[model samples]
Target: MKLPASGEGDVSPAVHHLVKGSAGGVTALFAHATGFHGRVWEPTARRLPGIDGHALDLRGHGDTVMPEGYDYPWAAFGDDILAAVDGLGRSGAGTGSGPVVGIGHSCGGAALVLAEAARPGTFAGLWLFEPAAFPPPAPGEVQHNPLVEPTKRRRPAFPDRSEALRNYTSKSPMDAFDPEVLAAYVEHGFTDEGDHVRLKCRPLDESQVYVSSLVANVYDAMAEVRCPVLLVQGAETPSGRFGKLTSQFPDARLEAHPDLSHFGPLTHPERIAASIRVWLEGLGTRI
Candidate 1:
């Protein structure tokens, strides 16, 4: 589906997203990590029955179009979530008369925090996986994103999905992804050209996203988030960075997966879905 641009920044006029399951009971809005499209959540969405899952392709990722000279500010991504939520409400996908639950990972998780802070009561609850929201750097301290330089060197085109899959499978991080999940990533994360397939998220754009993460600190704003939050992280992810997150929120806890990594959602959808189901059920939600 297409939605109007968030209008929070110099963004394109349209936003693209994907929806699953029409048997609405509780609507689950999902936001993906940077460089990933919304459809990558399909594996987990299908695991939980009776959920109206709406996965948004954050600006510059997936099929969402972007305007020239537009810098990807993290706040604009939050507004994109707002736009999608409004669009869903208009379409009756989220007309339950209350805030919906949010499921997000990495950059997506931070964006959810930004949204809830920008507008209180925007979400009833949030299940975040290693959200990039960090405390503001101390005086004279400098924060840098190590992924930016590597992301700039990412290949932007491939001969086809097969080639892309092969290339990623042979690499580090991506090689850890679940086979099915990685397949979806390759299938929907690229667009076909006359002779080759190009990544929907250009290398330069994705690199900029990494650069923006360091400066978009939402730790203080999290105090305004009255909703319950569950922050999940793999044992491998340094607890030093994610542990303090629980203390920033009014009602929040941390969950660890010793067997999973930061990309646990993509590496083991079933496990992540089970955890989400248990948390949602504990909140008194049906199914």
Candidate 2:
């Protein structure tokens, strides 16, 4: 299951990840969204008890630290996905596994798609939740990601974990999450910086990810995906409704849950997991 890096001598940092699910089951890789650590997938991973899950804290978002001068290009995330999937094989997580599937949210989901695009047959299937990609720019249209300013405006350092918890619990998106999930975000989402707690994922770094939306034309890559792709979207995803997403992939299904949001995987892991479980069953022995 070793996948080659896309560029010559362009080495990516080894990803930091955690595994879940039963030992003898399908191998699944989970990627998190912007401003979140990999542990955020714990709830959903647990729901997929039949899946052997691996969760990655992509680059700057979690415990994995990038070397100095690392350029957070959109393509680099694709490389990281390939490297992480390759790592699962080295750890025997992907070896002799029933199925190797990728499950991701937003940026994470898009990365999985890019990884599959880079190396066909690398994954058995894909489950993506409102991954951030749009049709290619119209000729010379400039990059116009709306989240950059909002990310820049985010508070960089929290006084303490309790304060962080309170802030998120009282905040907009986080307010919509489960208490346990919110606690998880506060626990692993930040680090101690002197007397204060700084965000594990820097604000500018996350903004860079959002602003680099066009790093690759995922819409163009969608047509080349040979594996089954299940596009998951919440009832009210801020990314809007991508109704045409199913037509882009060769073998794709769309699931728009009525009560979910962009970060629904965090708040409704069991629900999302159940959806995945049903999808796997429908796939029969392939999963």
Candidate 3:
């Protein structure tokens, strides 16, 4: 498999990205969750055929640096995705054949939906894996969970990058991944901080992310989407949990895998990829 030379630089709301594949028509851009980097999609990307693949590090995650005072709003993450798409489109990487497919996981899934809604026809289709779009809080209710707080707080900072990597890999949902694949995640998911290197994701940023989810309304923008959408959800997920929002889309299909968890792409990339391939084929896209 050919891999594009990875490069780093600033790109507005988002900081950097590790790009792969040729600058050809009809590309698929991937977005990952808060604690994860774009490399999480490497396994799936390797299995996909034909289309160019680009994995992006969303704001405040992976190698990307969030803009100052960004507040880590979910909408800002949507803007960053648009910036990446524009960057690729302007570079002639996404022009020509078909609209780019935006594939996202967890919170990334919400951002992708937001991006598509924000700009109809901007994406050919959307493939989302268990996006964490829970229902909005009841009226006059306020969440106080630490995971939903938006205050800056210190977290464990390792003395070495390897230690941080070890800590992350040992506890991740993708712990069973091949060593080489796990190592790739470590390389792109951390930063050296002299006495200690720490995972690139900050706790406060993660908290803000959860809080943002509670307030953002992905369903509100569903009608704006003008393309096919495939939502792959975990069967264990309660039917009404994700804002009961699936019914909002005019052209959407839902596939639930009973045995899969939220980490379907990482834990079952081949299955997910095959499902996606079949779905795309049904859409009349030559694969």
Candidate 4:
């Protein structure tokens, strides 16, 4: 899939994406988590037999040029995803199968919710894996995100691609992920600088996404997504309980994977794919 600077009524930086599978198959639009690009979704996408997958590299993250001011909040991200979905539908593929499915992990999943909210009937179904959305805050309560400061201080450059890959593959949360997924992350997550490769998404920019978490009405937005929804979360991850959100929709099911954590989608792509495949099949068997 090509990157369009703007579509579906909004001007923002173009979103980069990759496509796979036959055009005749049902279209599956996927969004990645924070700090990663679209290719991270490949391992999972490849496993779905009859679904054409379009995985996107969101703003400031991949080939998509990051706009100035680091102000592309969650609302902006949702518009970007919505435009991409329209771009795919305009391609004249998978019309017989109904609206495409929306798949997202972490912040990506939250963006999908905003997209479906902004544009009704954008998807036939949704598959969200531990999306980073929170319920209504308590009375006079404050929310302090732990990830912002750490992410801001994160190292932004590596001596070499090998070192970057090694550092990532040898780490904890990332270390547990599939080798192929990690490779894809490193490949699309950085660009070459003069003497080394710097991260495409600078630490500040990545943290900005985390910092802007509460700028939108996340809890209220859940009602806008009324399509068949499958909510998947790691049993052990905090903020994974979304029973309240799921209950708001007419057709929604929640699943908890006892053995996984927040990064379940990346760590266990095959297992996650199997679960999603079953849901997609229930939506409509691919030709």
Where does candidate 4 have its weakest 10-residue lDDT segment? 8-17
Model 1 per-residue lDDT tens digits across residues 1-287 = 67544457634323333344444356889999999988889899889876667788888988886765567888888888888777777666553544478999999998899889889878879999988888778899888999999998999999999999999999989999999899999999999998999999998899998888877857877788888899998874443777787889998998988788788999999999999999888765522
Off by over 4 Å in 2: 1-24, 67-70, 138-143, 236-241
Total backbone collisions for each predicted model: 0, 0, 0, 0
Query: In terms of TM-score, which candidate is stronger, 2 or 3?
Result: 2
Candidate 2 colliding pairs, count: 0
lDDT of 2 by residue, 179-284 (tens): 7678877898899989899988888888877877756667777888899888988885454446677678989988888678777888887788888888777765
Best by lDDT: 1
Question: What are the RMSDs of all candidates, in order?
Answer: 2.4, 3.2, 4.7, 2.6
Candidate 3 or 4, higher TM-score? Answer: 4
Whole-model lDDT, model 4: 0.78
Please give each candidate's TM-score. 0.92, 0.89, 0.82, 0.91
| Global local distance difference test of model 2 | 0.76
Q: What does candidate 4's lDDT look like per residue over 187-259, in tens digits?
A: 8788999999999888888888888986666667888787888888787545545776677657788888888
Candidate ranking (lDDT, best to worst): 1, 4, 2, 3
Q: After best superposition, candidate 1 residue 271: deviation in angstroms?
A: 0.4
- After the best TM-score superposition of candidate 2, give how far the Cα of residue 232 lies from its true spot, in angstroms: 1.2
